[model samples]
Target: MSEIPDAQPFTPVSDVGEFGLIDKMKAALADAADARDLVAGIGDDAAVYRVGAAGSDGPSRVHVITTDALVEGVHFDRTYVPLRALGWKAIAVNVSDVAAMNARPRFATVALGLPNNLSVEGAEALYTGMAQACERYGLAVVGGDVTASARLTLSVTVVGEAEERAVVYRRGAQPGDLLCVTGDLGSAAAGLRVLLAGKDRMTAGDGAADDPPQPDLTGFAYAVERQLMPQARLDRIEAWAEAGVRPSSLIDVSDGLASEAHHLSQAGTVGAVIDAGLLPVHVQTALAAQRFDERAEAFVLYGGEDYELLFTIPEAEASKLSPDTYAVVGQVVEPKEGVALRLPDGNRVPLEAAGFRHV
Candidate 1:
């Protein structure tokens, strides 16, 4: 006897919207692994969890928590980015947030919604990459939930701890504080250009005609790596404490320099003047931008997702820190004049919110 096949044809997930897909996912995650720490998981206004010992001496170590969500077609494209890089990035971005707070990340939980198209092996590959990241950063993968969905979505929540005094905030910069940043900027934006160009070349019928030259990734690789697997500047946070140089204000440059400068200014109730020439530009980043016929200075100013730390220090106290590590790029001014950039050609340009906007 010949067995009859199912009558209905398989349909691609695009037919259903995000909510329908989420509902389907909830059902699949009905049976969750048992654990004592997870007070609540899934199906709630918010998931709750307990931490620390029942009774402990010393001020309850400050608990730092952050969450980030990456949606396919928005945060990443499957064609250009590998599953491993995707997993690493998913955790790196959240770790960057923890670093910005000057905290030590200890644990994380990941929740993933995958499409039918991805194989079980592909999903495991992603986990392997995330596990590698956990090993590198000294964080434990405490828990997570996985389910099927129409599109790929990854959300990670990282928990960290810090001493009360060591934690830095964005609202502390005062008048006359020197503005500084660790590492160079704009390379990530240039790397994005390279990746997009590569995609264009592959998509066009002419694989050779007018094809852009192989991206010279010398400096650009750092930026590409920053975008793929950025290291949170936790070491710098520890160094600053060791040097007794407490930042008056601090922010991570996930957005462009101008935008972060504006953030510091607004939060601290002060204005700032940044010297364009003083802005750090790595040699490779400059060369990569030149190759693409783009202005490196503009990329440094307006390019986003560099993930370096932007901080302010009192001028007198700043001298105590090692000169080899930090640069004095600007200074805080009275709130009368908004954020301005002093150009190399002896002109001043007003700064605006030109960073990456999710919405």
Candidate 2:
């Protein structure tokens, strides 16, 4: 008898990475739903669908939907990250996605996977934290499901609304558009670095009986808070609306400056050059980077979870934005030029997505 054929090997997700897997899923689900009312289905900060308003003959308003999940070991550690902060962050992250689409987040639903060892009070504290964040962002927590799990997990979904014409995507950037970002970058990453250092100190037997020595966070409070709870840049979206200016393309900076820049460039089939000198780094963030003996620019480039908005706008609209809140860091270019980072010394290097990756 002929020998049996060898079993087929399966592909690991890491081979193609997080975005590659998303691209594969996007292709497979292209025809899964009707396309008539779908504004944007996949490969965006949020999914937008068109729906008519009640008793209105005017243009349909679009609903933006987004979801994000936080896993215990992967996203946080209870030893340093408080449950309340975790809860607030869970909701804020999804809101950031909606804001990235230039929509106003109105409601949210939370799905939780609870570990059996957790206490009822612990769960309630989490919800309380979520409620606090909801109050601040003007979001209502609807309903969701709960189930047992090996570790604690929280998944938040947000729904937002906007006029059909107000929605922005990541594919409309032109060669002359200016690249901008709201607020400073890398502060959240610096915060995480501070928290992790504290954790290491505690675990290394640096505490007295019944009391432990904590990391001296006197000057790093801003960085620490940024890591534990980061606010979404919804204010920038509101500012744009008030000024009657819209970005040609928009994305939230959850995956660092370099990665998000590449995203905008690839989405628009254009090229970009990020000026290293123009990147805005917070004072506290720079201090944290120095404390860790790391380059401040590295933090700004590769620090994920900033939750700031990264976008491209026409030169005419750039003047309308407040200089205090926004910074023009680069310019869009032809596709042949690709993406590059112009160093302060005038040297240029290819800008790649070396930010956070799921895989």
Candidate 3:
């Protein structure tokens, strides 16, 4: 007798989404889980572990590891993105995860796949950007791999070290804590809009979101630059330590404020209320928004790639943080209240995680 034919075609990964895919993978491997030394696994920014007598400082030391990848057609485009900036961005993304853990980045290993079109100079420019990032973030590039591929890809793995107690987790937010963010939001998204518009004009009015053009980038210079070369707020991480302020919970805003805030609150089993008026938007972001005939606030809440820190702290410590360093944009509320956002005109609504999607 013939066997039954397949019941259905394979499901598209997009349907599950990035985080959903991660959960599926973790669950598939859950049976082999070893939890003794694993402080955190697949759910957060980085993996945290209890390091033993290895870090010079002995048992109190904890280790964190995070990896990030940038691909030509997926994570970036060749049209307006500079190779150097892309390199810096790849490093910044991984380092941002380390910062989320409130850990000091110590070392990184890069594995890059180069296309035939990239010249020695192009490769050098990319490495230079990564070098700058490493120096700025106090990290060393110990080793890496270089390979040839049809498309360019850069994968960076970062290792960070910190005292076990100093490491922040996304699950520690308390109901009375204040919601905080470092630096401004929405600038990068504005810049991406400018680039896309320029490309469309170059393609003779086709608005397809691919291809390249050396578009006049002065429309919103700062916003465009932010899209290409964003910083990872490492200095602010240092300052938080300097002030002796340990955030009750922490995350980096790579996906966008809305998505990140939801992630943090859900992980912590709490809720948040974001004040729309309290979000700090850069001047260039506003200008870019007007040029595109869009609301500036949209980018602030939903634009991804700001790479800023989203955290929560006790009200007492929150009061001590300077406004220049931290913006208390909201407060953790009871889980019964749910995650909500307060608009400028005094309307409150559910905080939706409707931001950039990687899948």
- Which candidate leads in TM-score? 2
Q: What is the TM-score of each candidate against the true structure?
A: 0.79, 0.95, 0.92
lDDT of 1 by residue, 1-359 (tens): 99998799877776664434655776677566564655434432123344567687765456667778888887777867789988887877777777777777889999999999999988997898888888877788899999898889999999877765666677677878999988878877767776776676566635565654453444467667766666667778778878887888787887789888987886448999999889888776787678788888777888877778888989888888888788889888888767999988978888886776543
Higher lDDT: candidate 1 or 2? 2
Off by over 4 Å in 1: 1-60, 206-219
lDDT of 3 by residue, 5-115 (tens): 978988888899888888998999878887888888888888989877544654477789999899888988886688889889889999999999999899999999999
Please tell me which model should have the higher TM-score, number 1 or number 3. Answer: 3
Cα deviation at 356, candidate 1, in Å, is 1.3
- Per-residue error (Å), model 3, residue 158: 0.6
* lDDT per residue as tens, model 2, 27-122: 998978788878898889999998785668876799999988999998888888888898999999999999999999998999999999888898
Specify the poorest-scoring 10-residue window by lDDT in model 2: 205-214
Ranking by lDDT: 2, 3, 1
Worst lDDT window (10 residues) for model 1?
39-48
